[model samples]
Target: MESNSSLGTALLPEESTETSFWRKVLDVEEVKKQVLFSLPMILTNAFYYAITLVSVMFAGHLGELELAGATLANSWATVSGFAFMIGLSGALETLCGQGFGAKTYRVLGIYLQASCIISCFFSVIISIIWFYTEPILILLHQEPQIAKKADLYMKYLIPAVFAFGFVQNVLRFLQTQSILMPLVLFSGLPFALHFGIVYTLVHWTGLGFKGASLASSISLWISLILLATYVVCSKKFEHTWGGFSSESFRHIVTNLRLSLPSAAMVCLEYWAFEILVLLAGLMPDAAITTSVIAMCVNTEAIAFNFTYGLSAAASTRVSNELGAENPGRAKTAMAVALKLVVLLALVLVLALVFGHNIWAGFFSDSTLIIKGFASMTPLLAISISVDSFQGVLSGVARGCGWQHLVVVANLVTFYGIGMPIAVLLGFKFKLYAKGLWIGLICGLSSQAATLLLITFRTRWTRIDLSAEREQGTLDSV
Candidate 1:
């Protein structure tokens, strides 16, 4: 194998042909580095998701109606606010990760600012949507009671939208520099505080469902403040954190050229599940079906956090290698990240299979709801496993600046193929939630396969790292 000095390590020796592939994979120092880099990110993502799950659990304890309402509101928030902000901010993963590796330090801060600005602008529009969520839900033919309560719940979550945008911006800034510990510390600490705040507001203050929403918003702002403080005070960012600049505004269009497609790719995948929940709400037993699917989806979200961390690590590693003008190392990084995520996925699949009955009980005491969730585990396992690979592929695409291509892939597979199948089996054939989830599995599988083929066929050598460098320099000028 060709050696890649840019990784500060060498690939497996070509002469060592007798060595087993798995052993060579394990022995590679770069693989270990990638795992370590992703570990903290995974933990941080877990805590972030945990905070939301806790809110949902709190709502579940109040009543089934409350649970359904909270789930609907939360789903809308994710589709309208969180996914868009996170996806748009992913432009940083490409720009900042490569910038850091290329030693173009200042560009990272500039990109971070640009992403923050754009995300904040979009948040305003999303917040307005949230303000009218009740009407929107009614328009979609949702149950009137659930729509009313969910709208009330979404009202308190509006502030968190902007806070979330800032958090993503700062997180990307630190992530690209290989700074993972602060993210863990800040996110984990707020998550602990979140439970207490939620309990107090919901029980002691008698705010009910609104309290749970407020708790989520408050926790996000706290995390955002802590992270922002660290970025300002930490010496690690001395080179990257040049104070705010007018350049951020100027680069808005340039950054959107990447961010919009990224947003589309991510939103399409995320909204597909949200749409599943919406479809379930219109089924025979709206409350039970929506509640059950929401619980299962939450479980999948937790697992997705693990894969998402791997994706982030892949993006950083691949972008770093490419920025260093080592396409060979970039390819190696992708291969290593994929292998690690697949192993993790298999382990998760087994755990979900064995623990399905027990896991569903965590969210609700209702036997019917637990049984409903358990029935979906097999399909969830399949979807989650395939989605793990798809997630990392998306990260790789982001690093390679192939966001536009993936957007097309996501739209075709998810909408053109998956949605029609879901609607057919779910409603026409009356397979209900199972049919919807199975459709999602098919969509993920198609997306994963398509991305894999693209990665395989890519001409990495054709990437013009110098031209990217020149463009960044010109933008700064």
Candidate 2:
């Protein structure tokens, strides 16, 4: 009987041809696992993003001037404050992720504290800049009235920066441990509540435009409080979240080494999109060009946010596997992530291809703007495809603690190669909006290619963070 059972088990593959073929091609289970992991993260990120956008929407209905001011303020907040905060927290993806894997559990809390400290320090600096936004905008040749309105919106938005930083850092701390479902709840709840808060302030309380910015501040803090409470109270983190210690202050310098480069890696890419919008303002049909380019930027941001979940998953998987001293498994994990990215990108590109006009209509009623977006749809598709590849790769880089190398890649590719061609084609060659997007596509392709090379040529190894902890530096990498 035992021999017959063994014989039947051995012959199972012959009966299931599809399963055998997939087994030969890829790890079907791992792909499914990543897809499941990515969904919650996608929802969490989208929810957090919607909190601010919803505020802008509420304020936009007040008046055209209100809309203009609120939009500019929101964009400025993202570039100078929110993007930098998100980047600074990226260090924890490496530190906390690997530490959890290596069973150096207590170190995760210490690193989280250190990252939060760093965020607070930078938020102060950025707040000072936000305070003087009126002068800065005027200096940059913005209309004085619009600049003043932006300045008003920014001042009220300042408190949100500190909250945003803490929220992001805590997110990384939890994300690294695969504590994800709570994130969707915590982030989604605040975002849902934010709509009511903005409405009350904008309409019921009579704060007007200032209320929209202030509402974002309140909602972000709500998110932080919920997340902080969970991290503090949950038994799931008992091994990792030791109560705060003075020791974290000592690790600030170590966190900064990676955090600074991570911040630059994010900021460079973000600034490039804003720069394109600014250049559009200089075009012959500045109104139409600026509107279309801004829409494109927003469209790209939305797509990236959608893929960001997979990127986060890739980072966590690679870092955790590496920390477990399984380099081959880490490589296989990244391969699976890339495959998923390709599949997801194709779906997104197809959606954009078939529904380009419908998507554009949401942003504007102007036929000219809609037509312009339709014309740029093909280039946008290519860029989105490449951007998806790079997003996962960038997450892998964060996991590998290679932000320094990635930053240099971003600087050289986006600033050195991408921007020069954009200028030449945009102004010199007369391509205008299409030319600007084409230049951006060039940058995205170059960046994706560079990151791909780095991932392949570089060694995959875990940082001995325990050793670094004892040595007082992260140089052990």
Candidate 3:
């Protein structure tokens, strides 16, 4: 008599077949396991979101002008930092996932070190962007008082997270090796330290606002130290010291190569939204308070972080299967990720929708702005769904070394079409806030469609294992 486990195996027939892809994704039992892995990722992002909301609420106490300054400055900081980080980490995803699939442990450590080295270089560049932020604000014709505050915020905030990014890239590299808990568990360390330092020193110390920002910088470095210690003690870097070989430099080069195109694509998309926000601030009634606008954008961002977390996991999963020469598995993994992402997005949107009237109470007590934000629920729903698809496809492309195409597609979709149309609707049509968000929908929607189409039509089966095996070159992704 066949046991139940053996009978189940007999019913399944095979693991690697393409026909089995759907079953692997949908099997009631397997589906539960995949969704379960995603839960920790969701909770981790929820903590990060909580930190942002707390920061905003506290900044709101500093007054509307200060809140606006924080909003604009943090917008720039978040988008630019993301562009720079993704420019490098995309390559780490590809290399480490593939290396793990191939059981090449030494290559994994080399990739990690190279990514950290380049991330340090970028941290310096991002800090300088802050220094020049004042001139850019002036060029945008921001009010002089607001511009001064925004510049201060930019300068102070960018440096706070500089060294911290190196730790994040290392975490992403380790994630591809499938040991993700250390990275996930320790991510909140920086925030805890940041809150304690900023809260205590901001009031107790005489340093004022600059003191608050500096405290965050101190916290960031401490978190970096803690994570770096874990990496060293975990023995994850042992085999990577391959005598300063050219291949090591190539790993750094490879990360940037993949990262640059992806960055260009995403940066263009982000810049469109930034432009709209600026345009909204330029409108007549906007100056009374930008709080309504800030709440709308930032609250939605809390949800967007989930997409990022899942995308990271998807990139590794798809890349691993591809490296193992299991295209069927890769396709299955992407499908599973896509479905799971939308499921998560809808669940989140429902929470946002049901709590719509009450959402802004946490950020501000002004009933008027809360009403304005409640009106924005539908747009938020559509936008989150659009952005979710774009995120997943980017993951799929990264897994397959399709970085260059993503860049080109994003450029055309965002700048070539979406931005032009968005600006026309925003400034010329006189639609104000509604127009700005509508434009965002256009930009992200087009980019998402292009990514989905490109990923779907390609033949995922022809993986070049021997070429990847070569130690000489690693291209953009």
> Which candidate leads in TM-score?
1
Clashes of each: 0, 0, 2
User: Model 3 over residues 380-452: C-alpha lDDT tens digits?
Assistant: 8888888887887887777777878888898888888777776777679976676667777887888988998
Whole-model lDDT per candidate = 0.86, 0.85, 0.68
Q: Residue 425 in model 3: shift from native, Å?
A: 2.1
The Cα RMSD of model 2 versus the native structure comes to 3.2
List the candidate numbers ranked by lDDT, top first.
Answer: 1, 2, 3
Give the residue spans of candidate 3 off by over 4 A: 1-33, 45-53, 236-247, 288-290, 465-477
Flag regions of model 2 displaced more than 4 Å: 1-11, 15-17, 63-65, 285-288, 461-477
lDDT of 2 by residue, 224-317 (tens): 9999999999999888888888989988988998899999999999888778876776777655676677778778887888889999999988
Candidate with better lDDT, 1 vs 3? 1
Looking at model 2, the pairs that clash are none
Backbone steric clashes in candidate 2, count? 0
Model 1 residue runs over 4 Å out of place are 1-23, 466-477
Candidate with maximal lDDT: 1
Worst 10 residues of 3 by lDDT: 468-477
